[model samples]
Target: MSLLQEADRNHLINEFQALTEPVKLVMFTQEMECQYCRETRMISEEVAELSDKISVEVYDFVRDQEIVEHYNIDKIPAIAIVRGGQKPKDYGIRFYGIPSGYEFSSLIENIMMVSRGESGLSAETKAWAANLQEPVHLQVFVTPTCPYCPQAVIMAHQLAMESEFITADMVEAIEFPQLSNKYQVHGVPRTVINESTHMEGAAPEPILLGKLQEAVA
Candidate 1:
């Protein structure tokens, strides 16, 4: 059976109806002996096919040295989203691991929000978002089995998609145990903003935004 059933496919297609501008998903993978790398490419392509405004571009990590350096992609099987470039640029958003399970939904919604150039934030939050001057790095550590992890990942990804200065990543905690140790991720849905501020569980959008702002401050 496919990962997404008919009902799920229909839901996603319906969701794509809201997108506006163009968005590109850039997949970086090595040609040979890459695990879950092919799956990432396939998932990005399938999702991109759902909407005319979104497209996918695959790059060999081993071959694209300049792009890898430009995007600061230190690892393979990375996926980045640029506004509308076949080649990912300096300020593109990055995903370090496979965004499977609930994270998959987060991925799709991110593309939609970015394409629309809008966020589901209130007027007060929008004002704060408008004032963002510095870059914010959000790392949401998650395990696939955690029921509440998706919420954190979705919120972070949404913020990244909404703001050019914010880049969010849903890090699979199990896949990167060293990251977990480095960040001291003993729980699910633990978000580390800019390597200094950390918050656990799925926080409300406003609260998370405030945390990000404080991290920059």
Candidate 2:
């Protein structure tokens, strides 16, 4: 069964026409695919089928420990958006759970962003990232049902694209209960900066940059 509908596939084909470079969607799953793990892989494969510029690589979370460690992947059903080639170029943009619902848009957008090698961030945000001295990890906790979640996820991902020191992840709260509880993610679109400061709701680029500034300071 196709995870994507006919109309959506057509739309994606047109959207993907803008791609100038190749993209690799490296997905991690175990033998006994965890909750939504199978669907996540299916989604990656389906999306990759839409464009010749895109490809999918599936890896076992347990069996592929070396590649898993290299990518810094610690969980199942994770998707890493990277530039495609013999040597995959990683930008540290990741989806910690299935990029379904609104977050699906985030996945697609990140693919395009990676292909173009541009962050689409404001000048100020780019400037801040250029001077960042410490590594920043952003985990945007979200639910598939949340309409506003993609904005937060996209902004964090843009930061990751802009800075080598910044890594961003979109975490589905329901899919990862322990992680959500650890961060006390009681609200959707909660952006966690450096595992410390957290902001609720879909924050704009300036606010995110300001928060990032605080995290590294």
Candidate 3:
């Protein structure tokens, strides 16, 4: 069975027609004890079929230690978007779970951003991200059904796209219950910055930037 509907596939093909550069979706998954790992890889492959410029690479999380370490992937069902070229280009954009529901849109947007090599951020946010001296990790916790979660996830991803030192991940809270409990996530759109600062709900760019600033400060 196809993960995407026929209408969705046509829309995605049209969207991917704008790609001028190649985009690679690197997925990591283990064979055993990993829920949704297969589905994650399946969706990535399905999406890759839409565009000639897009490709998917599936790796075993347990066996591909070197590749996993190279990409800084620490979990199963993880994805890394890389711009294909002669030079090394990893914008540190990642998804830590199956990007279903509203999060699916984020995955498409990320592909476009990687293909264009642009963050699509405001001047203020871009300036802030460019000047960052410290590393920041953003984990946005979301459920598959939350309509507002995509905004939070996309904002953090944009920041990651703008700054090399920032790594952003969209974590599906329902898929990883232990992680959700560890972070004490009781609501959707909860963005945890550097594992300390927490912003609940869909925050705008400036507010998110302010939180990022606070995390480094």
Candidate 4:
């Protein structure tokens, strides 16, 4: 059976109609013991088929050792979103694990962010993001239907794209429940910066930017 139903496909197509630029989703996987490798690839492919502005490229993790190294990917079922022919200035929002569950919305939001070049950040946040001097790592935990999750993930990803020193990831809450427990993720959209600081919920642009500045400072 097709991964996406016809009605769902049509809805996705309509949703993506606003996309004006190209968004490339590069997925890497191996046919070995990786549990979610196949499913991850399938999700990306199905989503890409919904829009002409979106394209999916699959790479064999084993055969493309160079890509594995170049992208610094250590896990299977990983995805990197690139814009145009260039590697986006952002960290490309790694999906180390499959973005199932609440993370499905994260995937869609990420594609939109890349396509529209828009973020949930304010002017002050944008200014802070532009002047990032040190590397910042953002890990956002989310579920697919969490209405507020995308706001945090988009802000982090935008900063990654705008600054050379930022990398943001939206991790599926269910897939990484252990991580959630470890980080005490009692709610959706819990963002951790540099593995040191954590913020929960959909914080506004200025507040999120302040958290980022605190991480780098």
Candidate 5:
């Protein structure tokens, strides 16, 4: 059974046809004890089939220790979106669970962002990200059903793409219960910056930037 509907597949094909450059979806999964690893890999493969410029690489988290360390993958069912070529362009964009529901749109947007080598951020926000002296980590906790979660995820990803010091992750709260519990993610679209600064809802770019500034300050 295909994970994507025929209409969705056709739409993605058209959307991915605009890719100016190739994009690679790198997925890490282990064979045992992983709930959604297989589905995650399958989704990556299915999406890659939409465009000639897109490709998927699946790796075992346990066996590919070197590659795992290289990408800094710490969990199963993880995805790293990189620019495709002889060399991988790691923008530090990641999805820590199956990107179903609203997050599926986020995955597509991220692919386009990387393929164009553009973050689509405002000049002010870009400047802020470029001058960051300290590392920042953003983890956006979301459930698959949340309509507003994708906005939070995409905003963090744009910052990640703009700045080397930033790493953004979209964490499916339902899939990773322990993380949700640790972070006290009782609501949808909860964005935790640097594990300290927390934003409760889908914030606009300016507000998110303010939260980032607060995290580093």
Candidate 6:
């Protein structure tokens, strides 16, 4: 059975038709003990079929230890979206679970962002990201069902795409219960910055950038 409905498939095809460049989705999964690993891989494959401009590379979470370490992936069912084809650049954008529900929109948005090589950030935010010298990590916690989660995830990815020092991840809260508890993610769209500062909702660009700056400052 297809994971995407026919209407959704058609819409994605239309959306991907505007892709200016190829994009690659690097997925990490293992055959053993990983929940939704199979489904996640399937989702990547299915989405890739929608456009020739999109491709997928699957790596086993256990067997591909070196690659996993290179990507710094701490969990399975993880996906990294980068410029496709040769010499692809990692934007530090990641999805740490199945991009189902509202989060599916996030996957599509990041692909568009990567394909066009555009962050669509504010001028001030872009300038700030360009001058960033230290590393910053952002983890946006979400559930598949959360309507506002995609906005938060997409904003984090925008910063990641703009700044070399930034790495942003969209973590599915329900799948990773222990990690959710670690961050005390009592609500959806909670963004944990550098393990210290945090944002509680789909903040606007300026506010989100402020949180990012606060984390590094």
Task: Give candidate 4's total backbone clashes.
Answer: 6
- Report the lDDT tens digits of candidate 1 across residue range 151-208: 8876777676556687778787877778999999999899999899999999998888
Native-referenced Cα lDDT, model 4: 0.79
TM-score for all models, in order of appearance = 0.85, 0.97, 0.97, 0.86, 0.97, 0.97
lDDT of each: 0.77, 0.92, 0.90, 0.79, 0.92, 0.92
Residues 133-186, candidate 6, lDDT per residue (tens digit)?
A: 999999999999999999999999999999889999999999999989999999
* Alpha carbon deviation, residue 175, candidate 6 (Å): 0.8
Native-referenced Cα lDDT, model 3: 0.90
Name the regions of candidate 2 deviating beyond 4 angstroms.
Answer: none
Residues 99-178, model 4: lDDT tens digits:
77656777788888788777656677667778777778888888777878777777777777676678888777767767
Candidate 3 vs candidate 4, lDDT winner: 3
Segments in model 4 whose C-alpha atoms lie over 4 Å from true places: 85-91, 144-147, 177-187
lDDT of 3 by residue, 25-121 (tens): 9999987838889888989999999999998989999998999999999887999988875654888999999998889998998999889888788
Per-prediction CA RMSD (Å)? 2.8, 1.0, 1.1, 2.5, 1.0, 1.0
- The stretch of ten residues in a row with the least summed lDDT in candidate 6 is 30-39
Clashes of each: 0, 0, 0, 6, 0, 0
lDDT of 3 at 154: 85
